[model samples]
Target: MGFRENEINGINDLNLCDGEQAVNKTELIDHIATSADISKAAAARALDAMIDGVTTTLAKNDSVTLVGFGTFMVSERAARTGRNPRTKEEITIDAAKVPKFKAGKALKDAVN
Candidate 1:
């Protein structure tokens, strides 16, 4: 049942710096597996589920809030006029619903 045992072992072998190094998807999956005591495949599925749920909720004009983590929501932007830098042509920027996130108090506190 150690389908990802080799990958996990490889991740553990790498020396990761706190803030100096960028952690990629593999590292993230490895972390999830170790922290949740689940298989890498399960962790990947869980992450995918979370992403899909957030995207679906936002598409419905709703938000997803992980109490101690953050909130994912769609914010509206008003139509505005803008100028193109290269051609210096004026343009109308259409209003749209953009995704946003605000970290929760716990997450903020944890970082600081």
Candidate 2:
């Protein structure tokens, strides 16, 4: 089958699981086949390199600020308390390392 409705709705057409510019093997191949008019195998390697570059750089706590695109960073979430909506029970949320993105001013302006 192709991509599910929820898997692609309103998401970037270039970054769909089944559209193009996907992060997975099959989708990456599809993307390469279409966008760059490249062979599937070559596209796969390109996607791999892109993903590896992002992962290794982020691991070092360095922000990948794609000026006017956005900034990708790893941030620590301080431990905090939250309530379970269903049970209304208080719970302690453990601290976590999370990948975050803050769109640049240009992006925000474009969105608005």
lDDT of each: 0.80, 0.73
TM-score each candidate: 0.80, 0.59
**Candidate 2 lowest-lDDT run of ten:** 1-10
lDDT of 2 by residue, 64-107 (tens): 88889798899999999999999999999999988899999877
For residues 1-112, what per-residue lDDT tens digits would candidate 1 score against the true structure? 1122223433432335645455677777777888678999999999999889999999999999999989999999999999999999999999999999999997797567
Off by over 4 Å in 2: 1-25, 84-89, 105-112
Worst 10 residues of 1 by lDDT: 1-10
Compared to the true structure, candidate 1 yields what TM-score?
0.80
